[model samples]
Target: MSRTETAARVPTLATVLDVIRERVTVSRVELAEATGLTAATITHAIRELIDVGFVHEVGTAASSGGTPRRLLELEPTACYTVGIQLDRFTATGVVVDLAGHIVARSSMAGAQEGEPAEVLRFVADHVNDLLATAAVPKSKVLGVGLATYGPQDRTAGVLLTAQPTASWLEYPLTETLSEALGVPVLIENDATAAAIGEEGLGGARSSFATVYMAGGIGAGVVLGGQPYRGATSNGVELGHISIDAFGPACSCGNRGCVENIAGPTAVVLKANTIPGLADRLRLRGDTVADFERIARAATSGDPDALSILEESAAVLGTATVSLVNLFDVARVVIAGAAFATAGPLYRDAAQAAVDRAAFMRFAHPVVVELSDHVSDAAAIGGAVAVLRRSFEARTARSGAPAGR
Candidate 1:
């Protein structure tokens, strides 16, 4: 059964589903222990769920001193969700089962330069293609979720103002796509959703923060296993944080923001200033691609390339130190498209910086690590966001005490 979103309105159903979903598999006794729900409540709930074809009995579990009882697990293939990572240049899609495993995935380019509707049209096509490719029936598909650049009104499913573009401002992204695809749609900032993805399935139960770098740098600080989305769901604007009072101007009307000094575009812009470097590297206009080329040169012993990376690293380190200090978080995860190619470099440089500069370095000892997986974090996060929302909806429906 898909435990995608849970609402608290249905207390018994939500509590029971929440326990089963999180534990992966559980018997009545284990479910009781995990949810603090009594045996009768679990018994009644499980029977109802099984009757509705949501949960299934899958044999029995060994007991220490008692008779074994039936084990239950979510039927992953029973439902699916489509997740898309929408970027300026490309859109990547992934179809995930109820258990949040990617069952099918694909990508297409030539999206960045189009109009808003045009871009979403292409995305809709891909969504259809993804479902077809996965061979998952539409009835079993829960919804479509999108992870896009931030500064959005998540409550309204509207893309708000953001860097490098004004076209998407106040655009009803979710509604547009939902109407086109005929499926419920959900949207989230790529950074926040990616953090949620990591928290949900990356197996980390502790409070932490994730710094995701794609077209630009952004952050998602997860506290107590939930994303700390501030007002308007635009919290953790780590890239816009000012670190260089005298640095270059940013599109956000700020000077010396991290995006201006440490972002991929910033690195490319600075690389252009190196004497004869642009022509030597055959510099391309694509900031991310150019940055990757530069990173490769650095690894291959190019002094200019190495210097550029080091400079970018220094600025990023300074900004990261402030983030760790402000949050008092001990674990920092560096992620996003930026790390797709130069992951090790980012991990090493960021780790060294936090070790050397973070406040309470010895007391808390922040540890910086690369994302366990890269390339499609945002897309995966998007799908996970849908499941999580469903989980919440079910919980709300359960009519249990709020957050109980």
Candidate 2:
């Protein structure tokens, strides 16, 4: 089909493709049932997908006293996309194929006091290096996805908050990055991206919540197989959830926000009060590094380090109870670099809290688990976001109703 025809069919094609990717290998009958699309529509979408080299018949599945049905699966090498998680202290980039597997990865210093132009340039360079390392040509790349902190405008493709510096506020992030990288650029909230990535990993439950921590803490919720992006796509601010009204003030003009009280920075600050603890753990001034050091020490059975982390975990658990009560999700996923070493402690704490205090504890148990991606969840999610944007246009420009 011509490019114009393909573009016109994007909404339907994307919907069918998403179901196939999620199911891994599915027959047309299953696709139609899963997507609520008619069998003829499924056939047309599959034909287009096959013709474009994005999918292929894998094999046939056993039938229930009927002809064996052909199964289809994504063509992993049909295209590639890049995902970058940009933090204040560190940045991670990953080259992902259509199957959501990371082919190559890279990490480097973050935006840290850098101007928008310089940071975008660095990210562009990093993406190029990643593409070269993966041996994937730029022409095969669909686009780039950026995951970062928010309180901003996604439609404008610029950060609204002056985090790290005032210069970042309202910066033309997508436009500049797109110009430098020669591909479309999309931005997503880090925690939301991580949740999307986790969901894409395939799970028994379609609804869950993700708690993400790196330089800070936040959350994302997926309900009924869709991301619950609130008005403006900045809904789940788990970090800013106030845990104590009379405690220390937070930068977000709140009193004793959970992050301000028990986040990585808070845990590190609490550790600093112990004489010689900083030297003992070789605590760096950087919040992420210091938190990791403390977690490592705790993992090694250091009483002081363990106590500090436990205290922080307890506070976080309290906040998580609130999240459970509000969202009523059956599962919670802990993800991000901060959990690389101490994930279990936080998971156990969250699980215990939910078991003890969740409002729906009588109805069902809320399971808390650590994410498989850990440090790269957001980056991988960013890449998935790009793929979704290209393959799953939720709305068609021609005003046709999108396929479910």
Candidate 3:
């Protein structure tokens, strides 16, 4: 090829990879056609992907004309990553492969009252155990990705102004985890992590913008295919968006914040006051499970339960509509621990609210949906964060000299 031709050929393999990630499997000829590249160029890219263990020859596809073509697809196990989602009740760990499939997962008691060091040590131990079970080589393992509750120091990788977990203040999470596990660590607010995961693995993949709603009223935003972190990485705190100025105060010190009215605790607290729901659902446990039960009963046509949930949904939906107007997102994914029960109701209500209130009503319908798998979206997303960065760095340094 001439110098000008080579110069014009930007290393678009990453873009091609993104395309494949967003679609079902396809063959080289199809890929070449899709990207408007020559068959020979497609062959070289596929071979490189295969060499790096990122793509594999899955099987043969039915022939349209002459002969069957071997199918090339992502090798889910080419590399692995660790994803951890921390919450007030539990800190969960998962091992995910290149394709964002969870290979193994385990959970432990969350930090109740303890030093940050001890809590993190326990988390590290769980991750180590998961890696061993997955049997992925340490060399092939990508960095650790943390999905944590805020307020967080995203730049410093510290948990700040935590909810009653005073030990979390200014804790250097990335540094400590790196030292313990010998791997690079990336941390983000739990909502942002969910949003990233949704963009990569959920309905958001098809849409350019997404408003990712974490269960129990919190939300994260991804605009124009990028995570929107605002000024200080504390962006998209949907839970704290004010819904009522004269309502109860929220943990973020705001009266009538969305969380005070719409989070799982708030909903469950409301249910406990309702005599019929309290007796029928036996909503005594202060855990996500109890919240899930409340949501299920509400969706199943329990009057008292429905009343409690509808009120919360209206407040949450109002906040979500505001987000839709601000971001002009095309899709919204509701996920997290809260989806284990009442996802459908929230999806419908939020969709309706956005359609009625979003400023861009005439442009397009803002699609609202629930996560495919609520059980491990955060953990899997955590792992996705690692795999994404690992491959990105690899793709970037593929042409650069080592140690430069």
TM-score of each: 0.88, 0.91, 0.83
Deviation (Å) of 260 in candidate 1: 1.1
Candidate 1, 108-170: lDDT as tens digits: 663455667778898898898888988988888779889988777787888766433566778
Which 10 consecutive residues of model 2 have the lowest summed lDDT? 394-403
Question: What TM-score would you give candidate 1 relative to the actual structure?
Answer: 0.88
lDDT of 3 by residue, 26-62 (tens): 8877787776767776776677678788888878998
Alpha carbon lDDT of residue 100, candidate 3?
59
- Candidate 1 error regions (>4 Å): 1-25, 28-54, 63-65, 162-166, 401-404
Candidate 1 residue 92 C-alpha distance from true site, Å:
2.3
Q: Which regions of candidate 2 fall more than 4 Å away from where they truly are? A: 1-24, 32-38, 58-68, 392-404
State each model's C-alpha RMSD to the native. 3.8, 3.7, 5.0
Residue pairs with clashing backbones, model 3? none
Better of 1 and 3 by TM-score: 1
lDDT for each of the candidates? 0.77, 0.86, 0.72
Clashes of each: 33, 0, 0
Candidate 1 global CA lDDT score: 0.77
Tell me the tens digit of each residue's lDDT in model 2 across 1-404.
44444444554665677778788999999999987878887887787678768999988997788899999999999999899999797689999988777899978887888998898999999999999999999999999999999886888899988978899999999999999999999999999989988876564247899988888899989886667789999998999998889989988999989889888989999999999999999997988888999999999999999999999899889888998889999999999888999999999999999999999999988999999888898898898788777764422333433333
